[model samples]
Target chain A: AQRVTQPEKLLSVFKGAPVELKCNYSYSGSPELFWYVQYSRQRLQLLLRHISRESIKGFTADLNKGETSFHLKKPFAQEEDSAMYYCALMHDYKLSFGAGTTVTVRA
Target chain B: GAGVSQSPSNKVTEKGKDVELRCDPISGHTALYWYRQSLGQGLEFLIYFQGNSAPDKSGLPSDRFSAERTGGSVSTLTIQRTQQEDSAVYLCASSYNTGQPQHFGDGTRLSIL
Candidate 1:
């Protein structure tokens, strides 16, 4: 079974501070990881994907095969970055999502 | 449509009633997924449909939950004899294929009283 674990339920950071949301996965085969963000009054949107290797809204996540981790990171937190972040693992055409981490960037 | 569309943005129903949620994927998307989001559970996958093939209903919590996709485009999720535990925001997403990034709909908020 493929599983995704997001250790933090809430991450609070001051503006301009670095932010990292930890995510770990357990899967026997190759894993496809994705980061989805949901802001207040908005629908969930794709923030980034491991396969794309592109950063969205200054957020980037690197998939580490050895450690089985795909942690999302941002150099500096902004008030606009405050939202719910979910890590998802895709395998066999199904996606298993983590419990999600709520990020609050204080100004 | 420009994006995945889900109907009945909000629904309130009494326990034991049946509810149906609808989803319309992107114009040419072949893969559609149904997920449930609750306060404590966050997001849970319910089912997946690829074209007109049989859906993957492994994530469904019980036999009361069922889904069907027709004409390889529109899908409907049916919940029979709803319970309070079933209250949650049901989300639908679509992707071009198996490995592509999915686009999400606004979600249907279902409340069971």
Candidate 2:
């Protein structure tokens, strides 16, 4: 069985402040992690993937095998960054997603 | 279409009625997936299709749920005898191939009364 846990349900950060969303997964096989973001009035879009190792919209997540964690982080948060963030683990050609964390950046 | 497209942006149906949701994946995309999004449940994988191979129906909750991709382009998800618990946003996504980043549709919001 594979499961993804996102500890935070809601996060509030001031503009220009750093933000981190915690995500932990339980999977026996090599995990493929992804961060998907849903902005207001928009469809869910790929934020970043662990395999790609590229940051999108200043957001980056690194997969930690030892800890079984893939936490998304941003150095400076912006109002546009406010959205629902989901951590997803792909295994067996299917995705298991964590209960999303809603981020609100206050100006 | 340039992106994944789902029909019937919103649907209101009574319990016990059957409903079918349609999805048109991006042209040339070979991989299609179906998911359910609800209040408590973030996203639940329903089924997946890759090329002509048999679909991975393991994620489907019950026999009442079924999906098929026609000619590797359009996909339809059918739910029979819907229940109140079936009310949720059904999402469709597609990728160039298996294990690739997927592009999502706007999702069809189903409300069972």
Local distance difference test, each candidate: 0.94, 0.95
lDDT tens digits by residue: candidate 1, B1-113 = 69899999999999999999999999999999999999888788899998777888989999999998988989999999999999999999999988789999999999999
Error of 2 at A102 (Å): 0.2
Residue pairs in collision within model 1 = none
Residue range B1-113, candidate 2, lDDT tens digits: 69999999999999999999999999999999999999877799999999999999988888999999999999999999999999999999999999998889999999999
Worst 10 residues of 1 chain B by lDDT: B49-58
Off by over 4 Å in 1: none
- Per-residue C-alpha lDDT of model 1 across residues A32-71, encoded as one tens digit per residue: 9999999999999999989989989999999999999999
- TM-score versus the correct structure, for each prediction: 0.96, 0.98
Task: Tell me the DockQ of each model, to 2 decimals.
Answer: 0.83, 0.88
* CAPRI-style grade of the A/B interface in model 2: high
Candidate 2 per-residue lDDT over residues A11-56, each given as its tens digit: 9999999999999999999999999999998999999999999988
Q: For candidate 2 chain B, which ten residues in a row score worst on lDDT?
A: B38-47
C-alpha lDDT of residue B107 in model 2: 100
- Cα displacement (angstroms), candidate 1, residue A61, comes to 1.1
Model 2 CA lDDT for position A97: 93
Model 1, residue A82: displacement in angstroms?
Answer: 0.7
Best by DockQ: 2
